[model samples]
Target chain A: AQTVTQSQPEMSVQEAETVTLSCTYDTSESDYYLFWYKQPPSRQMILVIRQEAYKQQNATENRFSVNFQKAAKSFSLKISDSQLGDAAMHFCAYSFNFGNEKLTFGTGTRLTIIP
Target chain B: SQTIHQWPATLVQPVGSPLSLECTVEGTSNPNLYWYRQAAGRGLQLLFYSVGIGQISSEVPQNLSASRPQDRQFILSSKKLLLSDSGFYLCAWTGGPGETQYFGPGTRLLVL
Candidate 1:
């Protein structure tokens, strides 16, 4: 079974600053995918960024990026130039490269954007 | 683009009562659907997933059940609701492998 861990229960970042949310996972498979999802007050899950274990270049989407350390089983999300709207509950999720499509998600980290 | 929808944004039921929740997806066909439950201040717990119509897979042993009657419609049901079942239920769908999943607005279920 794969398990994702987000140690930081809560994180605060000032507007226009940068913040990183740490996440680690336990997986035996070498080929897998890591995803970061954002859930706003509306309770809607939004994809922030994704990293493929086979790719060492990492993944970047606009202001969102991920530092994927496959060997370390660590995938952290970094948000730059954070805005007030960035406040939300962030979750780290994992999926296998093969037939299994189910996503295993971490508890989550509540991000507070201080304006 | 694809859009997923879950009906009855909020539901309240008594213990031992029956449960039924519907989820639908539009602008796509033959999508893979999933049902997830999230407890208070917790992450998502995948309850069921269907790759095609009439195909349902359960992730955990629980009192709930799921059914997929149509290609884009999925339903979650329970014979008797329990207080522990109270939580936010989410519906998601993916086009295929390695694709981003689109989530619905989620239904909040409360069992008394």
Candidate 2:
């Protein structure tokens, strides 16, 4: 079984500032994928960023990026130039390359952007 | 482009009432479908998944059940609604294994 953990329950960042949300996971598989999803007040789950284990380079999508340390089993999300729209519940998820492709998700971190 | 849709954006039902939530996908064929529930201030819990029509895989054993009557349609049903079942239900689809899963707007279910 695999499990994902987000130690930070909440995070805050000033507009134009940056914030990093922590995430870690326990998995026996060496090759897998990590993802960060955002759920805004509308309750729509949106994909933030994705990291492939085989790739050493981190994944960055505009203002959103991830610091993936495969050896440490840590995948943290970094939001740069945070805006009000960035405020939402962020979740870290893990999935294997094969099988049913079921995702194991972390508890979630509520992000608040202060003006 | 592929799109997933979940109906009944919001539902309120009394305890012991029957419940049904519908999900459909457009512009995709033979996609993998998934049903997830998110309680207030919590992460998502995978309720069920289907690789094809009439093939369902249940991840959690609870009051809810799921069925995929058609390749692009998935339904989440409950014979008797429970307060514990109140949550935001999300429907997702993926082209194949390891592909990025896309989510629907989701339905907010409230059981009284």
lDDT of each: 0.94, 0.94
* Model 2 accuracy (lDDT, Cα): 0.94
lDDT of 1 by residue, A1-115 (tens): 8999999999999999999999999999988888999999999999888888889898999999999988899999999999999999999999997664789999999999999
Let me know the DockQ for model 2: 0.78
Pull out the clashing pairs in model 1: none
Instruction: List clashing residue pairs in candidate 2.
Output: none
Candidate 2 residue spans exceeding 4 A from truth: none
Interface RMSD of 2: 0.9
Error of 1 at B71 (Å): 0.5
Chain A TM-score from candidate 2: 0.98
Residue B65, model 2: Cα distance from true site in angstroms: 1.0
Q: Write model 2 residue lDDT over A75-101, tens digit each, in one string.
A: 999899999999999999999987577
lDDT of 2 at A55: 96
